[model samples]
Target chain A: MEKTILHLDMNSFFASVEQAANPNLLGKPIAVGGGIKKGSVVAACSIEAKAFGVKNAMSTWKARKLCPHLIVVIGDMTKYIYISKIITKMMVDYTDLVEVFSIDEAFMDITKTQDRFGGAIELAKDIKRRIKERFKLTCSIGIGPNKLIAKLAGELQKPDGLVVLREKDLPTKIKDVQVKELCGVGRKTEEYLRLLGVRTIGNLNSYPREKLVKSFGMAYGEQLWQMGQCHGASEVRPYFYETQAKSIGHSYTLPKLTSNTEEINGYLLRLSEQVGRRLRRENYKGNVVCASIGTGDDKTSSHQKKIKDFINDGYQIFKVAKSLLAITNKIRFVSVSVSGLLHQLDQISLFSHVENQKKVLAAVDKVNDRFGEFTIERAAIMSTGLQGKTGMVPPKLYGLRNFKMELRGIEPLTSRMQI
Target chain B: MVKVGTIIKVGVVFQGSKIIPRWFIWESRKYEVRSLDFTWEESQGLEKIIRFSVRDGINSYELAYNTIQMNWALENIC
Candidate 1:
């Protein structure tokens, strides 16, 4: 059977949520961003702000210059995640085949369930209506035979748009669209395509396959050909489907650029700990540790090394990352990540010290998992002033914690924030 | 906006699955909830919490209810 996929993309998600929560911001030009400091970029902008040529990912200063009256609100992950979860739940009510594309987007395989809800268009209308009524937010939904075309159709409209694109409609509906508009085609690829005189999707379709393969290699070239025909993967993996993570990493931008090794190491340790905590929580141990350092001049240096023994301890990860760190200029950003992951094999350690360290780490993980992240901290981090600065709590933690509470017939603390 | 992660007293009504905050006391002054702008739930360890973004007409405040403790706390003031 031909697949019927619906792609739902929230319009100006962060800014919309902010406006809904604070009525004062409604209909006003607003941009959701981090601290309005140097290098801070607008994460999302309201429709009012977009009218002034403000775009997402534009620097906050530049956005402010474009719309001087722009209300710059700090991005709040907790509220956004909450709203996203509710929206996801609503989608699941229609069909179990719901793939959360991002915090603000999802792809649903409504092939089976659409008929039950009168049809795909009816289901999409119901979803849009419910969202608007409940949260006062709007979303653009596109219906197509596959994910690629559905997403493309979604891009054709703006806030509260609903578009349907059948496979037969592809040639007439999107032949003139820019080739770069197809997902995954970056600026460099567009430039290369332009060199081949393939500027539109229609041009790409007519271009020789052998020539595309000769220029861009077999797999990518073939993928481009498929995209030109508006063909793509139709499988919508549900949210509950567990996929093994390829990497676990965290990075932090310092308040100010610094050349001090101690300060850099302090930030590195904090990042490693975060990465290590995530690794252990997911029951994965990795051999490769990657370190990235960003300089004040907008240059980044990244290095990764594989160790003999797989480890998930924060200090061990930090030691390996610190060795990889070789900085020359004043650094502003630091990152640590672990890759080459495998499910942690349960085995007794040969070294007595190593065994003790494992016990200590397990205990720390338990406490932090229950009370909050960084409930027990290292003496070194205390000196760094990053002791109590908690980041966003992962959704898995909330699910697990909520499950435990419900199982025990305990009243869940509604406002208990781990962040 | 002020982040006040302190405990405060509040009056609430549990209507079916909904939790409505009536009024809250912070620094010995009572502020009645004029409207609840938004509400959401969160969890920490084994504790589940419900948070409300409420306006008392003049200013907005974030109030949280800890069902396990059967208590209310003011989280933020805006």
Candidate 2:
């Protein structure tokens, strides 16, 4: 069976949103972040700002030095989230099997239904047109057989570009392009591959899988080899019920290192709430909680607690991290991370001591999910102020038993999807 | 260790003033307490400035942060 997948990405998301909302910012060198004194940096930069050599994540002070004319805007995450939900709605119109890959990216498995629609290329064109007409924003669309290929296609072009890649065109189109440009390829991986003279996708295609796996992890080695062949999976399963986290931790960088235990605890409470909210949203609860701190000198120390059971909720997670921080003096950075997750279980283990807390958290999750997130955030987090708002970051790992077999039927995994 | 006077820029997609030295930044908000990858030259005035970025009205505080701390005579540790 042939699969057609479509990936959509908003261009320069935050800055673009600012431009969309305010026409004046369109041609200007605009940055989205905190005011100068806020110690924030530019999260996104407009094309005009790019022209000035300004870039994302550059300090506002440095950005100002780089472009004195640059206009800065404090990020409005609420607005972006609103737009993201709307975009998700639009994606579902094309295929129910859509995976919200990131806040600004998604993959829609259109393979099984491509013949019913026009074709991969046509669908990509239509989706682009619809997005432009509806959102007044530009997006890059990539059409391919698997998520990896589809993601590659999306980046092949940018800012209202559409790219289509098929097996037949891989050999010719895959050459000349640097392998580092591939989705999963990063600085470390690229350097390692380059040492072996694997500079392009074509080069990787000829590399041995066993050797690659020995060097890279089993996952990356296999994924890269598959992507090299342009034969990755086409299965666009409904977004995974188990969301994998890139980093599962909460952190706060103090204005400077402080001995004030209250200030440190304040940050911990805020982070715990944020992490707990995310765990419950995805039906995951964690068993490992880690604490880390950074002194203003850029050095860090960390510790982890392996709990007998999993729990999710800001107050509890905060208690653990705070307990650890209580012993550390004059810390500059603080973080709380929970890992080793299990699906939300209905049956409470008879031996557990925190059942009452779990019950309270469940109610809170229901109310917040229904009304709006943060409708009932931890009171301790309130002092972090408006800027300390949290998000549904990636969720922690859940065990095999956590996955429901019923969801597998929605989309079958394929050869192309595996990589 | 990132020290005062460190001209450290976390994850910079590009240098603000020009394309020659600009690059993308990846450091996160949680990093505000410490200076991440920086050079000796970067630390020259690192003690005198606080830094952050704004994008499309959003802030990447952790990824992009710099600030100068008041100069306190260094206590040479063994």
Candidate 3:
């Protein structure tokens, strides 16, 4: 049976949310990003801003230079994540096979379920309308026989777009499209394909598979061949399946560059606490602890050490990370991470007193969870002015269970607003 | 842009669930909030701060409430 995959991508997600919340910014050029600080980068830009050559990841300084009137607003990631979750719940209502591609994009296998809603187009229209009515935001939806074609079709148009790429229409639809436009053909791959004189999907389709395999590896070459033929995996996994995290880490950029070792170590302790808390919360332990530092001149160095005992205690992780810091001058950024993760299991140990340590950490976590983070902190961290500082975590599409649980009891302020 | 860390008095209404700012008194003058544009939370060390992007007729202001300090500040105005 042929698969029917639908890709839904929110348009100008962060900026669109901002505009939706504020009517005055509807048609204005706005970019959602960091503070108005000098080196801040634009995380997302509105279509109106993009018209003036503004783009994501471009420095705010350069963006302002391009569009003098560009409104730069600091991003509210929690709100965006909240909205993303609500949208995901809506998608799950249509089909259980929903794969969240990103915070603003998802792929749903409505092949078997579309008939209930008349057809694929009808289902897409209904979902789009519901989102618009509820959040006052727009999204583009693409329907195809597989994930790749559906995603590419969705990217063909802009905000509030719907495109369908049937299997029979694949050759004509994608032949003229740039090979770079296909998913997985990034900058380096594009350059390599260009070297092979493969500029378009048609060109890639005509190229010899043997040559492709000889140039690239077997797996990637075959993947490219299939992509050129507009073929992709149709499986859409449920988000409830827990994907194992390879590593857990946290980092913080200092408000000011400092050479004081005590201050840097203080920051390291805080980061270790965050990483360790997350690891314990997720029921994972690791043997390797890594620490990294970024200097003012844009130089960064990192070191990792493997310990004999697997651990998830903050102080233990901090001790390892502090030893690895190497005491550098002019440090602007500090980070701590742990890898070599293993599922945590309760093991009876007489000498280690591990049970007592676990109990102490649990008590601390309970207090902090009820009140707020850093409510109870180490005495050493008290003077560093890093007690309640929250490091930025780039929003993830699937692993939002913890955040959702955190906000469960708190009434969302958006629900009470008149908008 | 104004300088950082300016404390101000803000009149807010607690509507059973969450706190909503209606107006703020900055520099001895009151600016009534026409609309609540956006709201988000931030943390400064152990202090959780709630920020609001609000409009007052002709201009927009960024106001924040520090839960630890139990005070409101006018963060910015544009």
Candidate 4:
């Protein structure tokens, strides 16, 4: 049976949310994320800012150069996460098979539920309307037979666009579009495809599969061939689906380039604690700890060490990370990550001190969870001047479990009668 | 923007699932909510705090209501 899928992409999500929250910011060019010092990159920008050629990931300085009056706002993750949860709940009213693609994008499989709303178009319009009515925000939604085509259709329109592209209409609708427009084709892949004279989706569809596989390798090349034919998986994993995290990491760039070991170690300790807290919260322990350092001259060196025992304690992770840091040059950035994960289970330590340490950490975790992140911190962190005002941390991705708003009791709105 | 974690009294109306903040008293002065621009919720452990971004005739303020404590606080101003 043919499946019906809808991809919904929020229009300039961060910027839009900021505008909705502040009446004065409405109808103005704005970007989210320059931190408190206004020295970082633009995480996202409004359509008004985009009109001035300001784009996401551009430096705030450059963005200012392009749009002199562009307002750069510090992001509030808690607010964004809360709104995202409410939006997800609204989507769940339509179908349980909803896959959150990102903080601002989602894919819903309404194959079984579309008929109840009369048809796919009606269902998509209803979702779009509900979102705009409740949040004063707009989204572009695409309706198609599979996720890829649905996403492509969504991309065809912007800021409250609704487009439908059936599998039968794929060839006519997208064949002339650039191969780079496909989801999986990145900059390097696009350049390689261009070298092969495959500029359009039509060219890729007719290109030799043998040549593709030989050039790109068997699995990915075969995948590209299928994408060229507009064939994609129809599966939409719901929020309840269990998924494992591969790694957990955090990195920070210093305000000024420094060779000071103590300051660098302070940053490392803070990052390690962040990683450890997340790992513990998720009941994960890892055997590998990796550390990286970036220098003033644009050089980065990284090292990883596999430990004998799995660990999730922040101090333990920090010890291993500190040992791995070589610090040959004056560095401005540092990162710490742990992988080789396993589900942590309750275990008794042979040493009494180790057991006591676990208890202490648990107590600390409880305090932080109750009050706020880093409510109880190490004295060393305070001395580093990084204690106050935590940066925005994006929610962990494991289905919709991280939303944490369901327990607050949100009553889903009843579906509108078919029109 | 200024961070003011000071606690203040707020008058609100609960209509179904919506929370409408009508007025708030801060620094011993009562300010009426000219507009309620945005609202959201955050969870800190077992407690859920409902936050509102509202504006008076002159200034904007952020107010948070702790569900467990049944109290309101002015969080920020701009």
Candidate 5:
């Protein structure tokens, strides 16, 4: 059966949520962004703000210049995530094959389930109505034969639009659209395509496949060709499906840019601890430790090294990161990550004493988990004034954390035999 | 706009599973919550705080309840 995919994208997600939360911001030009700082970037802007040519990622100072009446508000990520979860729950009620693309976008495979709700268009309208009624937020939904066309069709209209793109509509509907409108076509790709005299979807379709393949590699070239034909992946995996995580990392931008090496290392230790805690929580140990530093001048340098033994201890990761930090100066941002992961398994070592370290770390994790993150901390990070700082919570996409135990092949807490 | 981080006492009414802010006293002045516009939770280490965007007459206020501290704080007002 031909697939029927539906893509739902929230309009001005963060700004809309803010508006819904406060009635005063309704129909007013507002941008959700960083602090009133000079370098703060607008994360999302309302339709009113967009009318003034204010766009997301524009510097707040420039955005303010564009619209003198634009109200800049700091983004509340926790609030946005909460609203995203509520929206996800509503989508799940319609189909089991739902893929959360981001905090505010989701793709649903409604091929089999559309009949239960009249059709794909009816289902999309109902979902849109339900979300608007519940959250006082507007979204644009696209129904298509596949995900790519659906996403592109959704973008054709804004705020509260519902578009349907059938295979029959492909030639007329997408021919004039810019190639960049297709997913995976970034600035560089567009420039390359332009050099090859391919500017629109129609141009790409007329271009020779072998020449496009020579320009981009085999896989990507074919992918672009298919995308130009309005084709995309038909499979919509359930949001909870755990693709193996390649790396676990954390980075922090200091409140102020400082050249103080001690303070930088302190932040590095805190970040390393966060990464380590997540590694342990997910039952993974890694053999490689990577550290990256961003300087005040906006230049970033990173270093990674493979270790002899796989480890998930924060202190050990911190030590590796500190050595990498020795070569950099005037740093403003610090990050630590581990890759080359291995599924953690108990192994008795005759010469090594890693068991005691594991026990101590496990105890600390227990205490922290029971209370909250960073309830207990390492002595080195104590004086850094980083006590209350919990590194960014990786987005809990689709509330996947709720099914974490199941993914890890562990019994549910309620079902486990009590000790 | 008043910017205050002062701890204040608040009366909360639980309707089903929802926490509704009824009234609050800050700086010895009492204000009744006319409406709750929004609510969200944030965590700092072990401390979890639930913030409510509430309006009382002409003034809009942010009220926070700290789960760990077991206290209410008037975070900000506009």
Candidate 6:
């Protein structure tokens, strides 16, 4: 029997959630995005509003002009992420081989469990129906033999669409598809392929591997050919009640334009330690640390340091960051990324301080998880006083912390955030 | 990765080994089409341009407009 993969994607997820909750937003052109600030742009806009030329990444003001009646709403990530978590839970219950492709997209390997779920089509329909009834939003699903085709199939239809494709469906119908339809073929690739007189997938697949590799890079060219053949892996990642952190990074745009080193470092210090504790708790080790900052003038500066030997020590990262920040003066944004990750422990290094602090941080996390928040914070962190409010909350799991939705009724929380 | 602002139209759209483009755009301006793709030329005022292709079973003419352009597609054209 052939393998079965299902790709499920939510429709205008964030904006739809907002509109579903607020009855007034229905039938109106709605855009959900960053801020009213000039540089900020649309994150998601409704079908009605989309007709007005508003797009993701477009300035909110632009969207408004297109549809004078456009309703713009700032996003509440806490609520969206919470809902995403529950949806993930629903998918996991169906199969252990669930690959979380993104916050709102996932692929389930049901070839082995096909009989149990009635069939692939039945499973997809059930998932869609459940998601719509509970969230009052729509979704599109694609079923195929591999992850690439499944995702492609999902994209072929959208917003409450379902499409299933098999090997038998190819050639006559699939071969006529544009060259750009293949997975991972982006805009640049499409344009470049067009230059080569290759606009359809049928032509791209017929091109010899050597010719493709010569034109594009070896990796990309070969990958494209494989996509045409649908020979890639669709192996699903094991589903787990707990998930390990893949990467740890933090970015903050300066609340106010400033060149003050003290202010900058204070923020960096808090950010670094937060990253460190999370890494340690997950038993992760990172070898590369990057520091990126935007200037008040709108220009940006960034530098990264890779320790030949990696260490997850929060203070050490800060020590390195201090120099990275000194190179350029004015600041508007600051970000740090921890990479070259190792999944777990190795016998290579020993630090008593790390062990002790790891225990404390874990305990703190537990305490915070049980009782509303980080009711108890570190004294070292107190040195910065209060850092003020933030639009983003710490990355969290549904039940891990006080997963309250600023919008009431989304979650049964003790406190409610009103419009 | 069709972003929120990406523009698409109705007609024939393609992406590599797949010739099943259900939508196309007549205008050069980018769009962020919210619903089904696959539009016609005469109704919308342009010939054929699709930001991307999607399979909606049947590309409906219920969406037909002689200046068939979707309100979203027109916004970018301006």
Which lDDT tens digits does candidate 3 get at residues B11-43?
Answer: 999999778899989878889999887676654
Give the TM-scores of the predictions, in the order they appear.
Answer: 0.92, 0.69, 0.81, 0.92, 0.88, 0.70
Each prediction's Cα lDDT score? 0.83, 0.64, 0.82, 0.84, 0.82, 0.64
Candidate 1, residue A75: the lDDT equals 77
Worst 10 residues of 2 chain B by lDDT: B35-44
Candidate RMSDs in order: 5.2, 15.6, 5.7, 3.3, 4.6, 16.8
**Candidate 4 local lDDT, A25-81, one digit each (tens):** 888999898553534778899999999999998878889899999988888877887
TM-score of chain A of 2: 0.80
Residue range A1-419, candidate 5, lDDT tens digits: 67899999999999999888877788999999865665567999999999999999887889999999999887777788767877777887777677878778989999988998999888999999998887889999988899898898898898799999898878988889899888789999999999999999999877888888888999999888888767798888777666677888887666567788878878888878878888888888898999998887889999999999888899999999888767446766778999999875556666456777778899999888667666688988878866756433332211334333322332222234243
Question: How would you encode candidate 6's per-residue C-alpha lDDT over A347-380 as one tens digit per residue?
Answer: 4338887668656666776665444233555555
Q: What is the lDDT, from 0 to 100, of the residue A203 in candidate 4?
A: 96
Off by over 4 Å in 5: A326-329, A348-353, A390-419, B1-7, B12-17, B41-51, B64-73
Model 5 chain A: ten consecutive residues of lowest lDDT: A405-414
What DockQ results for candidate 3? 0.21
lDDT of 3 by residue, A119-201 (tens): 99999999999999877899999999999999998988878999999988888888988998888999999999999999999
DockQ of 2: 0.01
Model 3 Cα shift for residue B37 (angstroms): 6.0
Q: Please, what are the lDDT tens digits per residue for candidate 5 over residues B1-78?
A: 356998999999989978999999987889999989888776554678898989897778889999888899998885
lDDT of 2 by residue, A212-305 (tens): 8887889888888877777676666565354455335556666556777666777777778777776776567787888888876667888888
All models, DockQ values?
0.58, 0.01, 0.21, 0.64, 0.45, 0.01
lDDT of 1: 0.83
